[model samples]
Target: MSLLNNVFYFQNGIGVLANVFLLLFYIFIILCHRPKPMDLISCQLTFSHTVMLLTGGVVWVTDIFESLHVDNDIKCKTSFYINRVMRGLSICITCLLSMFQAVTISPSTSFLANFKLKLKKNIIYAFFYICSLNLSLYSYLIFYVGGLTNVSETNQMKVTKSCSLLPTNYIIRALNLTVTTSIDIFLVGVMLVTSAYIVLILFRHQRQHKHLHSLSHPRSSPEKKATQTILLLVTFFVVMYWVDFIISSTAVLLWMYNPVIQSVQKFVLNVYPTVTPLVQISSDNRIIKILKNIRSKYHQIL
Candidate 1:
C-alpha cells in the first residue's frame, strides 16, 4: 500500500477500536444509573459519538478504496451525507451539553435555574430542536455539494463520482466560510466560558466562608467530580475542534486548492469521535465504581 493509505488504515483502525470500547463503557454507565439527569445526557452524547465514529470510519475506508482504484458512487454519496449529518448532530449535542450544564449550575434562585429539575425530561427535546436547526441550515448549503461527475467549469454546478465543490462566486464563498467558522468559534467559546465558570464556582463554594459552601456539603454534592469531568470534556472539545477548524479555515483562505492538506485535515477531524469515547470512559462513574469495588474485594480476600 502507498504510505498515505497505510497511515490512514492504522489511524482509523485505532479510532474504531477506541470508539467501540467507549460505546460499551458509556452504555454500562447509562444502565447502572436510575436514569438521572446527567446520565441521560451522557447517554445521548455517547450515542451521537457512535454515529460520528461509524460515519467517519466509512469515509476513511472510502478514501482507502479510492486510493486503490476502486470507485463506488453510491457508497461515496452515502458516506458524504452521513458524515456531514453526524458531524452536525455531534456539534449540536455538545453545545446542548454546555447549555444544560450551565443551567444545572446556575444559582438556585436564578430565573433559569428552575429548568434544572426538568433537565432529564426536557434535554432530549432540546436536542431535537438543535438537530432540526442543523438539518435546516445544512440542507440548503449542501445542495452546492455533489459527486465529481457533477463538477463543471461552467457557471452552474457539476457532479460526477467524487464529491467536488466547484468554484462559486468568490464573495459568496468567502461570506459563507466566514459565517460558518464564526458560528463554530462562538459556540466553542460559549462552551469554554461556561465550563470554566462552573469549575470556579465549584471551587469557591467549597470554601467554608462562602454562602454557597453549605450547598456543596460533601455528602450531597458531586461538584468536584462533575466539574472535573466537564472541564475535561470541554478541553477535549476545544483541542479536537480547533485542529479541524484551523485546517479547514486555512484551506478556505489558501485558494481552497490543496489536496494533501485537505486529506490530513479530514483525518484530524475524524479522529475526535473515536477519541472522545476514551475521555468519557475515564470520567464515567460506573467504570470507576467497578474498578474500586474490584480492588476492595481483592484486598479483603488477601
Candidate 2:
C-alpha cells in the first residue's frame, strides 16, 4: 500500500470514531437540555457535523479502495452527493451559529433586539431551508461531471481511461468553491470582529459605570460565558480550517498538478468537520453543564 492509502485509512478511521461520538453527543444534548434556543440550534449543528464527517469518511475510504483497484461507481456518486450536501449544510449551520451568537450578545437597546425572540422558534425551519437550498444547488452541479471512478492500473489521474469535464466545465466548480469559501471566511471574520467589539464595548461601558440595562442583570455571568465561548469557537474555526481552504483552493486553481499536495490537503479538509464538533463540546459551558447533569442523574439512578 502507498503512503496515501495509509493516510487515507488512518484519517477515515479517525472520522468514523469521531462521528460516532458526535452522534452520541448530539443525542445527549437533545434528550437532556431544556431546549433553549441555542441548545436546539447547537444540537442540529452537531448532528450536521457528524453526518458531514461520516460522508467525508466514506469519500476517503472509497478513494483508498479505488487506489487499490477496487472500484464502485454507485458508492462514488452517493459519497459525492452526500458529502457535498452535508458539507454545504455544515457551512450554513456555522453561519447560523455565528448569527445566533451575534444576536445573543447584542444589546437589548439595539434595533435588532426583537430579532432574538423572533428567531427562537424558526431555527429548525431555517436549518431545513438551508439544507434544501444547498442540496438543490450542488445536486445540479453533480450532473455536469462524471462521478468518481478507477484511476487505472497505474493509479494516475492522468493515465485513467475516465476523462474529466472540459476546463470550461471546471469554471462552475471553481466558481462554486470560491464563492463558498469566500462566504465561510467572511462570516467567520464578521463573527470574530463583532464578538470582540461587543465584549470590548461592554467592558468599556462597565469601566465607565454606564447604566446599561442588560449589563445590570445579575445573570450576566452565563451571558458573558456564552459570548466568550462563541468567540473561541470562531477563533478555532478560522485557525483550523483556513489552511485547508487555502490549500484546497490552490490545488484546484493549479488543476491538480501536485498529487502529493492534493492528497494532504484533502486529508486536512476531511478532518476539519470532525474536529469542529469536538471544539464545540469542549468549549461550550452549556454542553459541559448537560454532561455533568447527565453524570449526576446516572449516579442517582444507579
Candidate 3:
C-alpha cells in the first residue's frame, strides 16, 4: 500500500473503532444504566460518526464494489450521500446537545428552564426531523457525483479514486451551497450561543460560591462538568467544520481536486468524527470509571 493509503486507513480504523466502542457504551447506558437527557443525543452523534467514517472511502479504496459487481456510479453516489447525511446529523445533534445542556443547567425560574421538559419529551422526534431534513438537503449529491470513468476529465472534481463530482447547473449548485452553508452556520451559531450562556452561568455560580464561602461545595456540580464538556466539543467542532467547509467550497469552485489537496481535504473532513469519541471518553467520568475497573480486573487476573 502507498503511504497515503496507509495513513488514511489507519486514521479511519482508529476513528471507527473508537466510535463503535463509544456507541456501545451509550447503548449500555440506555439499557443497563439510567440514561441522562444528553445520552440520547450522544448516541445519535456517535452512530452518525461511525457510519460517516466507515463510508468515507473504505469500499472504493478496497475495490469491494468492483468485486461485488456494484456499479461504480452507484457506489460513488451512495458513499457521498451517506457520508453527507451523517456529517449533517453530527452537526445537528451536536447543536441539540448544546442546547439541551444549556436548558439542563438553567435555573428553575430561567426562561430556558421551561424548554427542558419539552426537549427531553421531543428528543426522538427531533432525531426524525433532522434525519428527514438532512436526507432532503443533501439530495443534490446523487445528481452531482458519479464514477470517474476517465482520469483525463478536466471539469470533474475528484473526491476519491472511484468517484468525482459531476458538473451541474450553476444556479442549482449555487443554491445548494447557500442552503448548506446557511444551515451549518445556523447550527454552529446556536452552539456558540449556548456555549456562551453556559460560560456565563458558570461565572455567576463561581461568584455566588465565593460570596457564600461554601467550603462543603468544593467540587463543581455535575451540570457544570457536563456544560464544560459540551463547550469544549462545540469549540473543537466549529474549528473542524469551518476548515472542512472552506476546503469543500474551494473544491466546488475549482471543479478539480488535486492529489495532495484531496488527501488533505479527506483528512480534514474526517477529523471531527475521529476526534469526537476521544474527547467524549476523556471528558466522561463514567468512561474513566469503567476503564479503571477494567484495569483493576486485569491486574487481579494477573
Q: Tell me how candidate 3 scores on lDDT.
A: 0.87
Candidate 2, backbone clash total: 0
> Mind giving the per-residue lDDT tens digits that candidate 1 earns over 203-283?
755674365545436423464566566777777878989888777666655545455665576577766666666666666
Task: Give the TM-scores of the predictions, in the order they appear.
Answer: 0.75, 0.73, 0.94
Show model 1 residue runs off by greater than 4 Å.
1-7, 25-33, 57-74, 107-112, 149-161, 209-223, 289-302
Residue 117 error for model 1, in Å? 1.8
Alpha carbon deviation, residue 46, candidate 1 (Å): 2.3
Error of 3 at 223 (Å): 2.3
> Which 10 consecutive residues of model 3 have the lowest summed lDDT?
215-224
lDDT of 3 by residue, 193-274 (tens): 9999988988888888899987655335666677787888899999988998898887786665778777777788888889
Q: lDDT of model 1 at residue 145?
A: 54
Q: What is candidate 1's local distance difference test score? A: 0.65
Ranking by TM-score: 3, 1, 2
